[model samples]
Target: MGYGELIIRSYDAQNDRGRVEDFERRCEVGPAKRVFLFTDTLGDPMCRIRNSPIYKMLVAELDSQLVGVIQGSIKLVTVHKPPNDLAKVGYILGLRVAPLYRRRRIGLSLVIKLEEWFIANDVDYGYMATEKDNEASVKLFVDKLGYAKFQTPTILVNPVGHRRFRISPNVELAKLKIEEAESIYRKFMSSAQFFPIDIGNILRNKLSLGTWAAYPRGESWGEVPSSWAMLSVWNSGELFKLRLGNAPFSCLMYTKGSRFIQKLLPCFKLPGIPDFFHPFGFYFIYGVYGKGPLSGKLVRTLCRFVHNMASSKSKDCKVIVTEVGGSDTSRLHIPHWKLLSCPEDLWCIKALKNEERENLHELTKTPPSRALFVDPRDV
Candidate 1:
């Protein structure tokens, strides 16, 4: 039941849920119950894996105890060049090993197995995201696995409240069908992560309320629009809650938390509102993009419109959150309250076998210091 008796296989929810819970609580220190984040399709393993077309969840067991778990997904991303230009990329997420299994190389083994799974599925490139301060994960993916630090993204939490609801009459927000949304997204967004091909899957998700694009007043979508911005909202409150055991709220506030403090005073983060939501519910906005010189204005307009839309639907909807690369200037337009900022998250990547020599844009080019649209739908 010790080392040699360990087993790694696809996730078996019935037998593994208990062990997974142990691993979850053991690894995330501060608050035990607070770690269960609300996502669409609650309790489903695929939901935890970021809802990919093809994905695998692996778990390691010893004496029938689940010691570790990891998930990987494949997506065909259209790079800077399109029209038959695509990269079958593999993404690794949700890697966790029990505290007791630390330094046992079990973490490394799980990653290797997931990579093998990626290869078997015919992925041309592999990548993963982790905090810059996570020395173990960084080393595991970079030094040990030959992956390189790709992008450093800043994740911002923008709360929705009265101010956001004051959207200007000059700004018009329009909901778009998947086809309409993708047509524009593909045409304008170059740094987007997930391909337009799978966007329907994300927009149609039960947790996702809908998608929208913003065009300045007097300029409508499908018209000669000078600029455009788009966003999709997720009903996180309906999914799950963060129960931060006994950790002091002050401790969670990292930087100048005045902004976050002012907003949370209303207890928006608290659970159980008029909407039958036990946990604090908010709109998690993703798949956002702002293009054109007027994009900054469009970005602000889109955010306000989405926030107001969410607030009108649910009084509990009090925040919008998204992640962008540090080099991305779009962060300027996307407002945020600096409650806390995690260590910079680095995207590390590596090339897979039989990759096209000429069409390896993912490896050849780097994103500009402009807006980078990382679809939160991916994870």
Candidate 2:
């Protein structure tokens, strides 16, 4: 029978061990051979999808034969600060086909099933990621599936190496116990676009190597002060930094009320934003908005404080990377630093829905571009 006659279905946990073993055997000739081929012990490749308010899965099948699988999850994408409206978007990951089924429409059929799944879940847009050099996969996503390149996935590298960060006298850095830090993080995230990075999960899952936070000393007591930064070290000792600041008051004034105008406008008033606030300005950097003085002096102080902390933490790490879109202000500052190729590449598509198409214009006010960052493992 033709491969087109094969079937694709939601991953069956009962049969996953066998399926994974089969996949391993099929991909033995390519780069996939280098990595261990074991099904995630977590069992649900769609675990993230299940947690998502909007998630979907599909399998391609012809008669009773399994041919391929597709999975997607929904989330928001922001060019800047927290509280950005969450959009109905889908991410396509874990697309696989058995080697024997090559050059068949099974993969395409699987994606079509995913598209239907997205429509049912109210998702108007979809995106996925792939290695830059994966020609066949790229062609399939772009040429065959009609997916467009939204951003170039990049890996940024910091050849400077990792060293212990020292806090600037003007700024104070503290290593909050995980429990205490998570408490503060949860409270502060209510107004921000912060994702809950469970410290406990990090510890238990061995996802985190270490974590720390930095803020102006006197500002720590109430509301957990939005004007601080956090750094989490992953298993590879790679550093991920998040800086918090106020949203663009001017943009707010142009659209919303002026209540936060006083707080968010000052950063723009400064001769230049601090290095720390520039999202794409450096490797291993990320940011959120909070209330703060936007003066050059204040910016410099904050940047110094953050720099001290990051520099010190680099001691154990070999490389750092951050993702940024083309039109983000952070991109403007990136020219000031050194960078290298990133392994995590992005694959994005335009909105397929009319309302969402209009929303895209609003959300993505800036031009689209790809970002690169160096994976620590390669360093």
Candidate 3:
């Protein structure tokens, strides 16, 4: 039988030890960056998906050889059509196919099964992200699948240890408890893309260090502040290192042109190669929003304090980052890596239903999710 007859099934933890190695190998050769592979560091590939309350992981096997895998979550997404409208949606990520098993419809099969999962969960919409330059991935989602090119969002990365941030003395960084943070998020940032309605659960997660708010010092407790900004720190230590020389990519390619045989046994490994993934954990600053003229100042203070907190926690955690759609005006607030950044990556999506809803215009249309919010967990 052809590879098309491969058996597709939910992840099998006890019987899939070798597949984890194969999965990581595929990722090493695949377009997705290795630094983002948190599963590798976690030891068990299925831990995160199995542990998450809303996620599912799937794998493809051909005669007992694992060839492909995919996973997703049923999410309640917030949109900007009517501004702050909510929709039940699904997100597909961690798509991987073994290098030797490409071009046999395995990927399409995995996604088709995932779509079934989406419908089963009662979600009518599905989406996933890919780099703008990755033609293979873009083609798979857009051409093979019926997904439309949705919103393109800029990813802003900040290095915490590079320099000390100078938060204004007048601005106080009040670290709010989970209850306070959720209450504040509900009031101000409800319109953001994927703004968690269950924000309390997110804040209380073990990975979340805490959440903070920026406001004028000595301000009285009120329903809301005139000039304010809010952000939460998430620990990404589980994603370990993928350095230049040590990474599988470096071994498979040469810095200069070489014969085909040389490519096969390339020992490209060498000392002094820089590590792409952070040694210290990464702190993702998300749910950032501001209002009024003083909002800019409030935002800066929050970033600085977040940096300070990360620094004090340990020497290893240094990078901080966030993503907002290109059309979102809120991007003007945070200090990001000006020289180093991904311009805007596309979020490809499709609806599981036959009928199109009016409130989901931004999500289903061509221009797509202009002011959408990108949760750190989604990354």
**Candidate 1 residue 17 C-alpha distance from true site, Å:** 3.1
Tens-digit lDDT string for candidate 1 (1-379)? 4465768899877976656655655565322343333222334544545556787889988777778888888887754433454678788887877777778888888888888888888887788887677677887888888787767878777655554356778777788887776666667664454344566666777887777877788885767578877877776656543333343454445312544554567455332112111345566777677778887888877777776776667766656677776776667787676753342667877777654534444443655434456654554
Worst 10 residues of 3 by lDDT: 269-278
TM-score computed on alpha carbons, candidate 1: 0.80
Residue runs of model 1 more than 4 Å from their true location after superposition:
29-42, 80-84, 161-164, 190-196, 236-240, 243-282, 315-318, 341-343, 354-371
Q: Model 2 TM-score?
A: 0.54
Please name the candidate that would achieve the greatest TM-score relative to the true structure: 3
Writing each residue's lDDT as its tens digit, candidate 2 over 1-379 gives 5333455556665765455445533432223422222232133445434544456666555556556666776654332212344445667766777667767777777777777777777766776667666776787878897776656534333422222233357565555567765565445443232132332443333434344555676766345554555444433332122222343555334423332442467444322222222222232433221234422233334334444544564443323444443333333222223323444455556566766665555434544332222111111
lDDT of 1 at 294: 84
* Count of clashes in candidate 2: 39
TM-score of each: 0.80, 0.54, 0.82
Tell me model 3's lDDT, rounded to 2 decimals.
0.69
Q: What lDDT would each prediction earn against the true structure?
A: 0.66, 0.47, 0.69
Native-vs-model 2 lDDT? 0.47
